[model samples]
Target: MRLFGYARVSTSQQSLDIQIRALREAGVKTNRIFTDKASGSSVDREGLELLRMKVEEGDVILVKKLDRLGRDTADMIQLIKEFDAQGIAVRFIDDGISTDGEMGKMVVTILSAVAEAERRRIFERTNEGRYEAKLNGVKFGRKRSIDRHNVLSLHQAGIGATEIARKLKIARSTVYKILEEMKVT
Candidate 1:
């Protein structure tokens, strides 16, 4: 059976070095490793799609952690079922779990539930923090790119959206939005 390794981080700001290192330490070749810098909730990740196409029957896919595969239990279970049907096995490095046997399948089901619960806890905590911040009168979202006065002044000066965007160092869409807000030409 061919061996493949997958690594993923939720954002570009996060590093894949740790996961890659772990995969390499497990004897997976660098060329056999696939990685994605995307949230687990996203289904259009290029790296993951490529890996799915590359895997074949009797292939073993290795991941450093279960979260690297996905966070939603239903999605994870569906993916595992697909792999199981294809005679493919998935092994989590840290969890010491593999989908090659009945016990492993049971553990996967339990762990998927735990991962889903953990994701819910994280979501709840984030919302709680946001609620607390709003109660404290902390403003969020991007500050105004330019004040309304400046936008009106620039619009009246015959500045087009492109020029206004360049001068204000903001997106052309933002310039148009500012103009639209003031109902000015």
Candidate 2:
């Protein structure tokens, strides 16, 4: 079977040294190494695309981790299912997972579930923080561009949005929004 190695980093600024070295030491051909430096939220990554184009049924695609393939469990599972459907196997070097095998498939599913649960926890914590902030009377958003008197005078003058923006030294959108806010208040 053709062994294809996929190396990825979450951001363009990071290096792929570790993943590449691991794949090479594992006996993956240098020519088969595909690299991508993009967020895991993206499914159509450059390296992934290259690997998909090169690999055929019975070929193995190797990754550093399941997260390197996707941001959450759903995406990871979808990708695995797609590869399985094509009769292509995905192997996670770090996790020792292989879609070609039974145990590896189960491990990937478990890891993906954990990742999804962790993502949910993070979101829940963020929401809780926001709720506490609201309870403490802490205003969110742009925080009232200027005071009441300044905004009221501008609105009363019936000045055009552009003129108000120029006078306030803010963007036209901000000026219009302020005027809208004034009307509501």
Candidate 3:
């Protein structure tokens, strides 16, 4: 059976060196390793797609951590199920977790359930916090830099939208939007 490795980092700025080194230590050839520098939530990762296509029925997929495979527990379990259907096995180096038989599958399922629950709780907490902040007069997003009265006066004074934008250090689009809003009023 062939051994393949997949390494991933959530952000492009993050390094994949450590994971790649671990995979190499596990005996996977450099050519057999695929990597991505993108969010795990996205299924469109080129490295992951390539690894999926390259694995054979008896092939084993190696990862440095369980999170390298997916962003959420449901995604992880779904990926494992798809691999199991093809008779492929997955091994996590750091966690010492492997899926090869029924027992392994059961453990993965239990872990996935726990992870999913934890994710839901975190989401709920975040939303509740945001709601409370909103109730406390906390405004979100960037504050308006251009004054409406200044824009109106500039337009009335025969200053062009581009000139107003350059003088005020605001976007020409913002000048136009203000003018249009004034027109509507």
**Could you tell me which 10 consecutive residues in candidate 2 have the lowest summed lDDT?**
143-152
- By TM-score rank, best first, the candidates go 3, 2, 1
Query: Which digits, one per residue and each the tens of the lDDT, describe model 2 over residues 131-150?
Result: 99999998888866566566
What clash count goes with each model? 0, 0, 0
Ranking by lDDT: 3, 1, 2
Q: What is the per-residue lDDT of model 3 for residues 10-127, given as tens digits with 9 covering 90 to 100? A: 9989999999999999999999999999988877889999998999899999999999998877777878878888999999999989988887788677877887898899999999
Candidate 3 colliding pairs: none
lDDT of 2 at 49: 83
lDDT tens digits, residues 1-185, model 1? Answer: 88899998998999999999999999888998999998887656788888889999989999999888876666776677788788889999998889988886787678668767877998999999999999999999998657778767887888887987888788899878877877866
- TM-score of every model? 0.59, 0.61, 0.64
Window of ten residues with lowest summed lDDT in model 1: 71-80
User: What is the Cα-based TM-score of model 1?
Assistant: 0.59
Prediction 1 global C-alpha lDDT: 0.85
Candidate lDDT scores, in order, read 0.85, 0.80, 0.90
Error of 2 at 173 (Å): 21
